[model samples]
Target chain A: MKKYTYTEKKDTRSGFGAGLHEAGKKNENVVALCADLVGSLKMEAFIKDFPERFTQVGIAEANMIGIAAGMTIGGKIPYTGTFANFSTGRVYDQIRQSVAYSNKNVKICASHAGLTLGEDGATHQILEDIGLMKMLPGMVVINPCDYNQTKAATIAIADYEGPVYLRFGRPTVPVFTDPDQKFEIGKAWMVNEGKDVTIIATGHLVWEAIEAGEQLAEMGIDAEIINIHTIKPLDEEAILKSVQKTGCVVTAEEHNKYGGLGESVARLLATTQPTPQEFVAVNDSFGESGTPNQLMEKYGLTDKDIVKAVQRVLERK
Target chain B: MKHTTEELEEIASQIRRDIVRMVHGCQSGHPGGSLGCADFFTALYFEVMHHSTDFTMDGKGEDLFFLSNGHISPVWYSTLARAGYFEASELATFRKLDSRLQGHPTTHEHLPGVRIASGSLGQGMSVAIGAALAKKLNNDKAIVFSLHGDGELQEGQNWEAAMFAPFNKVDNLICTVDFNGQQIDGPTEKVLSLDNLQAKFEAFGWHVIVSNGNSMEEIVKTLQYAVSLTGKGKPILNLMSTQMGYGVDFMMGSHKWHGVAPNDEQLKLALDQLKETLGDY
Candidate 1:
């Protein structure tokens, strides 16, 4: 296993804010809209710098989506910021008709996704956003791992034409990836390569997978870890190649087991190569109010959970 | 480019003919709203708006129009064809397989005049306001116009957009509500009463204008006045009143024809009522 460590920790939303400001500077047409969570979404810098291009939609997520879709008509790349719950489930029809069905160039940037949203509980923590977003035609579903990847994704989606749902989290996590890495829309990042077992993860679970990989290495089990950021356009080639080499897989994500990265990987394997797989995610159950770490542990989405899933899958293999 | 009231009315008659013919050909469509808004569509496209026949998605230098009440697409398709956005012969393919003229307005098929897909109600106002904001950003003097059904305001998103435009000072948008008082189920009052619409809009900080939508002269005058009201620091809303079926005697003022196609005899009667001044497609 490759030794991975981060001396600093940062929330992914701040990265989104930094990336938005950078994207705005690079392209004059990039505009940001927020639904009354400017500070929570870490969009104050972009708003302060480009006051004229920013719109404060005042808690109206549906209107924000419609406005973003409309902004795309005149060549403006609008990024709408809100909680993951409000961004998808609350405004699915608006996104479907105005953005996806129309094929508009709008980036729906959602923060505070999944159990990581913490004390806000199930209402704010959206475990099914991945499924809601991926089901829409022409929608690119992206869940970046950490601060650096989130920033890169925020900037990268500005240039990609069409509708994109960029999902990130609120909790501060390890900043392990390269600060200057180029974010690809549909490409998977190979975190660590080993032939014994494959561990696929996304969003906050990527860091956990890395931790689990280190633990697995100490137990004399070589594991191949793959970071799948883009879930909709799943990097089938990368996944198939890694799974074929390992013959077993463990999928981890801070989402429901039914509709997150785990299901996507399982479906891919079942169709292409049929590999033994274990999911380290919340079962089909809503989360309760607790600290991020506590909720993650209680819901079976931690490094230990990934290690256990990997061990279980290895037994199956 | 200025058309006389008589000429606009003649063109509207032709549009009404096209609407009924297109609906009858498809055997499935909403003709009541289409027939009701024919004159308004004719007046706006032919006389009031400063637009180009060659359509582009980024309508930067030209006035943009979005049909929020997309169930009435037949009127818009005819208006677009008559305004030379596309060939008039394409109207025959309305609602047919692989045709750009979908059941509702959509940009999915690369339709020349459509910039956004809209069949879901209460979404057009936000889109119009956003487009108007974009015009302000680009420093374009062009205005954005949108039309909505009266019953469509039942969706909560409309109020969200309605509250947004005024507070944000989106002054370059001119939205009109087809105040026909009729919907698919029944009259709007029975379905859901939009109590005191003028007061509602006025309270929302919009310059409200009321006009008879079926009359070409009134629609033209109202639109011109609405255009003059732009850039004055308020979004304008026009409540244009029209009968559900304006021309055909049997269907006039009734909601039964809202989404029903006319049969052979009914089509002949509708054609007899509407004069084909510019000739049928």
Candidate 2:
């Protein structure tokens, strides 16, 4: 297995803030809107630098979405920041009519996604956002893995035309991956290539998959790991190629098993080439208040969970 | 381009004819509010707004209009065609398959005049404010205008947008409500009373203007006055009052025709009531 290490740790939201600041500097037309929680979303730097272009929409997520859609009319790329729950389920109609159906160039940036939202519990933690956003026509759904990847995605989505839902998390995770990597919208990043088994992961689960890959290597089981950041436009070619080589797969994500990356991968395999697969995600149930680590462990989304899923899938194969 | 009050009235009569004809042609549409707001649409397109007949989605350097109450798309389609945004013959394809003229206003089919899709209520105010803010950002002197149904304010998103515009000081937006007091179910007052709308807007820090929407002269003058009130640090709201069905006498002031199409006899009677001054499509 390829050794991966990080010199530091950082929350993905800070990466989003850093990326937003950078995106604002690069494009004068890039504007940011927040429905309160500027601190939680880590958008203070962008707001401080580009005060004129920033709008503080004071807890009104629906209005924020509408305003962002409207801003796209006159050639402004508006990035709306809020919790993943508020960004999707709360203002779905607004996003549907004003942005997706209209095909507006608006980036719906959501932070604090999945179980990593921690003590805020199920109310703040949104596991079904990917499903909601992906169901919309012309909506680009992205869930970047770590700090560096999140920053790159934040800046990259600014240039991509049309509606995009960029999902990131609040928990501080290891800063793996290249700091200067070019973030592609629909391309999958091949983390480690092996032929024994395939491990597909997204968001916080990518790091866990890496850890699981290291463990699988020690047990004399070679695993191929792929980081699927873009959920909607799934990299079917990459998944099919890896799964054909491995003949078995383990899908991991910090989301519900029914609607997240696992289901997408399963559907792809079922349609193109049927492969034995195991899902390492929360079963169709809500999460409770706990530390990020505890929740991830209790809900079966840790590195150990991935290793177990990989073994289970290998048995099936 | 400018037109006299008489010319505007004549154009509005033609628009009313177009609205009834388009609804009758489709056999499915909202005609009551469309008929009610015909004069206001005519006034805005022909007299008040400084817009180009050659439309672009990014309406920079030109006054832009959004129909928030998109159920009344018949009026807007006629207004856009009359204003030369597209050919008048396209009006015949309203609500038909593969036509740009959708049941509600949409940019899905690349409609020339529409910048955003709006059929769901209470979303237009935020969109208008955002566009107005964009104009301010680009340093463009153009204004953004939008029309809404009075009953549509029942959605909570409207209040959110209402609070946001004033707080952000979005001064270049002029939004009008079709205060017809009628909706699909029944009268707004009986359904849900929007108590003292002027007071509500004033409290929200918007400059409120009340006008008779059915009269082209009053609507044009009121819109002009609303325009003059811009750039003074407050978003303007025009509460324009009108009957549900202003042109056809049988349908006037009733909510029954809100989303119903006129039959053959009813269409003839409506055409008889509204004079086709500029000729039908």
Candidate 3:
């Protein structure tokens, strides 16, 4: 496996804030609405830089979504900020009818997604947002791996011209990807080149996949790592090409084992290639109040879990 | 088009006729609220709004209107067609598969004059506020208008939007609640009480106006007054009262006709009562 290192750790939400600030600078039409989570969502920079272009929606997520959708009527690109739970579950009908169905250019930026939301437990840690957003037609679902990619995604979706769900985490993780990396929607990044096993991961699990690749290398096993950032318009070509080369695959994500990136990959493989696959995901269960690291380990979503999944898929192969 | 009250009333009768015919043709739809809202729709489309006949999704340089009570799509479809957004003949295709005029209003079909999908009640208020905010941001000077059913206010989201608009000083929005006192289940008072609605809106810091929705002249006057109240650092609300099924005697004063299309005999009675001054589909 190729050696990877990072000098610092950063929360992905700050990346979103930085990206939003950059987007606002580049385009005056980039407007933002937040349901009173300015600090939590790391949107202070954007709000401070562009106060007139930002709105404090006072904890009304549904209203924020509708307002964003309506703002698109006059060529304004609106981005809504809220927790993953409130962003997707609390206002799903509004997002569906106002944003997705209307084909409005609205970016739904969700912070503190998945189990990494920690201490807040199941109510706040939304494991089903990926499913909810991906099922909607014309919605582009993105779950960036790190701070750099999350910021890039936040900036990229502004120019995409449709509804997009950008999911990020609260925990500060290693900033592995390049600072100036160009983020492309629906495109997978090949993190490492190998031929024995293909490990496809998204969000925080991408880092775990890298660790798993390094571990498998110690056992003289070569692992191919691919980071899938965009979940909706899944990078099927990249997945199929990598899976065909490896002849087996392990899919990982910080989401429910059902209706997530794993299922999306399984669907692609089942129909097109019928490759052996194993999922490194949380079994159908709610998360509990624990520290982020403890929860990731307790829920079996670590590098060891990915390594095990890769081994299991190899057995099936 | 600054039409006279008589000319607008003439158009209202035609719109009502179209409402009944559009519902009857499909043998399904809401006719009561559409009939009740006919005069107001006619007044807004023909006289009150500074909109365009040529259709575009971005109503940037012109006033925009949204239908929160989207089940009354017949009235809007007729108004949009008669106002030259599309052919009046297209009204016949209402509720048909692949038709732009869905059972409720939608922008999915790329329907002109509709910027958002409504029918899931209590959503349009916020959408209208957002559009109004957009107009203010663009410095377009054009206002955003929206209509809602009184019963629709029972939806909690409308209250959220109601609070948001005035708090944010979304002054370029004019939202009117059809105070018809009816929903699909029964009279709104029985279904769910909206006690002292005027006081509720006033408490939200909106400039409230009351109008007779059935009267073309009253609708025109009240809507004009509502427009004059804009840009005053507050959103305006018009609580316009109208009888359900206003023109047809049998359907009037009952919630049964709220979503029911007229049977043949009832359709005949309704057509006789509403004289079609403009050609029908």
Candidate 4:
């Protein structure tokens, strides 16, 4: 397994904020709208830097989405910020009709995704956002792993035309990825190369996959880890090549196992190459009030969960 | 181009005829609101807005209009065609299979003069506010206009948008609500009462005006009066009163004709009432 190290731990939301601040300076057309969660979404820096370009939409997610879609008409690229639940499920019809179906160039930047939202509980923690967003036609769904990658993806999505959903978490995790990495939308990053088992992970689970690879290596088992960030328009070829070499794959994410990255992988494999796969995700259940680490451990979203999934998939193969 | 009320009235009568014909052609669509808003759509397209015949999604140099109550698409489609955005003959293809004229207005069909897709109600106001904000950003002096149904106001998003526009000083938009007391279910009053709508808008910090929507002269005057109130630190609202299915003798003063297409006998009677002043496509 490849060695990975980081000196700092930061929330992916902060990376999004940093990237948004940079994108504001980079492009004149980039504008932002936040629905009463500017501080929570870490949009303070961007709001401070470009006051004229930001709109504080006072707790109306649907209205924020509609306004963002409309701003695209006169050539303004609008990014709406809110919690994952409010951003996706609450204003789905608005995003669908105005942004996705209308093909508006709007960026829906969501923070506090998955169980990582912690103590606020199930209402705030949204696990079905990836499925909700990816189902929309012509929508680009991205869930970057670390702080640096989240920031890079935030900056990159600005140049991309059409609707995009950028999901990030509130928990401060490992900042392992390069700070200067340029984000590629649909390309998967191969974290470590191995021959025995393949591990594909997204969002915060990506770090766990890397840790799992190291653990599996200690156990005399070689594991190949791939970070599949962009869930929709998934990097199928990268996954297939890695799985073809390893002969089996394990998919992990901080989402519902039924309709998330695992389901996508399962469909692709079923159609092209039916291979044995194990899923490490929340199995159709809601999260409760707990610390981010506690919730992750209880819900089977940690490094050990990924390691077990890899072991199981290898056995199946 | 400034058109006289007499000329606008002539066009409105033709547009009403077109609305009936288009709905009749598809045998499915919302016609009640369309018939009532014919005069307002005609006046806005021909007399009020500074628009281009060559339609662009980013209407930079011209006034932009959004049909928030998009069920009333027939009036908008006919108005756009008459204003030279497309051929009047294409209006016949409304709500047909593979036609640009959807049941509700949509930009998906690449329909000229449409910026956003809306059959779902209460979204247009926010969209209009965004465009108006963009115009301010670009330093373009052109205003934005949007039409809504009074029934659509029951949606909470409109209130959210209502609060946003005034707070942000979105003064470049003039929104009109077709206060035709009818919807899909029944009379709007019985379905859900929007009591003292003028007072509601006033409380929302909007400059409110009232006029008869079916009257060409009043629609022209009220729209001009509403425009005059713009750029003074508040968005303007016009409470346009009209009876659903106004032009048709049998369908007027009721909600039964809201979505149902007219039968052969009813179509003939409706056609007789609305004269073919402009040549029918």
Candidate 5:
């Protein structure tokens, strides 16, 4: 088995902002629209260079989706930015009708996703966004692990046609992925390999999986860590191959246990391999204002949780 | 290609006939607004708009029109057909299974003339504003046009777009409001009075124009004037006055036929009044 180490930490949203600015320089058709969150979404550079292309749709997410859909009709690729809660849940019908069902070529760039959107609490944190977005017919759901990957994925989806839901988060985490890595949409990134158990994680949970792998190694439990970036087009081939070798799995994400990455992996395992699986996610409850560390600990979403989940699933195997 | 007064009336009469036939074929569509906007749609397709005979989804390097009040799709379909965007024979398939023309105009069916699906109200303005911005981005010079019902302005998103377009320098878009003063429930005044519509648009930083939408001469003249107002850094709006259910004798002056297809006897009478100018599809 192979291992990797992290030396720096950065928020995924900053990566998205950097990627968006790069996309502006690369593609002429790429235009951005934010619902009055220019500074928050880190779209300042894109706004600065191409001031005419950037639109400020004030506090109106639904109208922003509608306008983004319209912008695609005239051969302009539009990226809509806002908080995940308001971006998906608040404007589901608008996205459903105008973007997804119509099959418009629009990029829905969302920030502040999942429980790691610390201090804003449950009202702003959106745990069901992945489920909601993935359920749409033509929607591509991407949850990048760290800053570099987030920036890379943001730039990648600009060229890929059709409707896309790009989900990133607040709070800086491990920035282990390479700065210039070519981010593919549905391909899983394998960090390490082992025979005892497979850890499938997404978003902020990828680093947790890596930490849990190191912990499991001390106890002589060899664990494989795979970062599942694109959730909707779940890399079924990679997942099945890993689960076949390991015979058990642990899935982790900064979202609810019911509908997050864990549930997606469990669904795949149930029909295909029938492997024993455990989930490291926020239990069925809303989060309150707290530091990211406190919330992860309070909700049992730490590396210890992943380590325990791996052991529990191994017991089933 | 200027149409004389008599020719304009004939074109309007033909559009009215197509509207009846389309709604009757569907057995479920709004006919009153379609009838009311027949003259305006006829003028745009047959006389006013500079359109391509070969229909493309992206109307680049040419004028583009969007129906913000998409419930009036029958009128648009009839006009598009008369203008040769599609075969008139396809009119019989309106709202039928696997029809390209859905209950509302949708691009999902690969309909050549439609760019976006729009049955949802309050969304068209923003879409029009976006298309206008796209025109600016492309440096295409061609204008973007949109039509909305006066009552549909109740949707808050319309205001968001209204506040946005003018400030964003979306001057190439000309928005026309069908101030027919009627809605599904009743007269717009009785349902919800949108008093001073022209002033309301002006307050939102638009250059206001007024016209009798049902009159071909006024419609053509006002739209031509609207064309000249492009590239001025402010959106142009036309407060178009019309009569709900304009041509039909019995359906006129009320909101009874807004969403209802006429019965057999009523359909016969309505068809008889609207003479078949280019032959019914």
Candidate 6:
């Protein structure tokens, strides 16, 4: 197993904020809209630097989507930020007709996604966002692993035209990826290599997979780690290559197992190679008012869970 | 500026003829609301709105319009074709395969004169408010226009947008409600009473205006007056009163025709009452 040294820890939302400011400097047509979550989504930097370009849309998420879509009509690229819950489920129709079907070049930046949005409970923690977003046609879905990668993905999506859903988390996690690494939309990153098992993960679970890889090394179980940042356009080549070597898979994510990263990988493997797989994900249930760490443990989404899943998949193989 | 009653009536008849022909050729579309809003649609496209035939989605430096009640696409398609946004013959391909004219107004088809998709009511107002704010940001002295149905107000998102527009100083938007008092279910009053609509908009800090939507002269004057009230501190809301099924005697005063297409005999009767000013599709 390979070891990565990290000196800093940061939330992915801050990366989005940094990317948004960089986009503002790069393009004058880039505008932002926040639905009363400026401080929560870490969009204050963009607001402070480009107050004229940032719009405060109050608590109206539907109106924010429409406004973002409308802003694109005048050759402006509008990025809307809010909680993942309010961003997708609350305003699916607004995004469907106004942004998706209308072909508006709007970037929907969603923060505090999945069970990682702790303490706010089930109402705020949205585990079904990936399902809702992926079902929409012409929508690009990107979920970055760490702070540096999230910021890079945000800046990258701004330059890429069309509608995109950039999802990030609120908890501070290990920032292991190089700061200068170029973020690609559909390409996956290979963190480590081994020949026993392949561990594919996304979002906050990337770090967990790395930790699981370390534990597996101690038990003589050499696990390969793959970071699947883009959920929609799964890195099929990377996944299939790793599976060809390992012959088994373990998928992890801080989302529901029913319609999340795990299901996507399972579906791909079933069709392409038919490999045995285990999932480290939340069961079919909503979250509770606990801390993010506690929820991760309770919902079987911790490092130990990934390690166990890797072991279980090896047994199946 | 005042419009003569004879001239206003002539435009109404021509618009009605277009509506009947467009809906009949499509064979599947909502004709009742199109006939109901014929007079108002004619007034805006022909007499009131200062838009050019060379259309673009980014409606900069000109008044913009969005159709919230996009189910009544027959009227909008006919009006857009007659106003020279597209070829008048395109109305024949409405709701058919490969036609730019979708069952609902969509920008995906690259339809001219449509800035956004709108079949899912209650979304156009928010889009209009956004465009209005963009106009203010660009320092362009142009008003944003939107038309929504009375029943579409039931979508809670409309109230969210209704509360947001005035609070955010989106005053360049002029929104008109087709208070035709009907939806697909039944009478709006019996289905869901939208009483005190004027008071509702007024309470939201809007400059509320009322007019008879069926009268082309009233619609033209009222829309002009509404446009004159732009760039103020508050958004403008017009509760234009109209009959659900107007122009056609059998379809009049009913909600049954809200989404139903007119029969061949009914189409003939409607065309007979409305003389064709421009060539029919």
TM-score of chain A of each: 0.99, 0.99, 0.99, 0.99, 0.98, 0.98
TM-score of each model, in listed order = 0.99, 0.99, 0.99, 0.99, 0.96, 0.96
Give lDDT per model, in order: 0.93, 0.92, 0.92, 0.92, 0.88, 0.88
- DockQ, candidate no. 6: 0.71
With a 3 Å backbone cut-off (N, CA, C), the pairs that clash in candidate 5 are: none
Superposed Cα deviation of residue A69, candidate 4 (Å): 1.1
- In candidate 3 the C-alpha lDDT for residue B102 amounts to 91
Model 6 regions more than 4 Å off: B1-11
Looking at model 2 chain B, report the run of 10 residues with the lowest lDDT sum: B1-10
Candidate 6 TM-score on chain B: 0.96
Task: Enumerate residue pairs that collide in model 1.
Answer: none
TM-score of 3: 0.99
Better candidate number, 3 or 5, judged by DockQ: 3
Tens-digit per-residue lDDT, A166-235, candidate 3: 9999999999999999999999999999999999999999999999999999998999999999998999
In model 3, the runs with Cα more than 4 Å from the true position are none
DockQ of each: 0.87, 0.88, 0.87, 0.82, 0.65, 0.71
lDDT by residue (tens digit), candidate 6, B54-158: 888787898889999999888888888877898878877888899999999998888889999999888988888878777777778878889999999998878
Model 4: CAPRI class: high
lDDT of 1: 0.93
TM-score of chain B of each: 0.98, 0.98, 0.98, 0.98, 0.97, 0.96
Clashing pairs in 4: none
- Per-residue lDDT tens digits for candidate 2, residues A36-77, read 889999999999999999999998999999999888878999
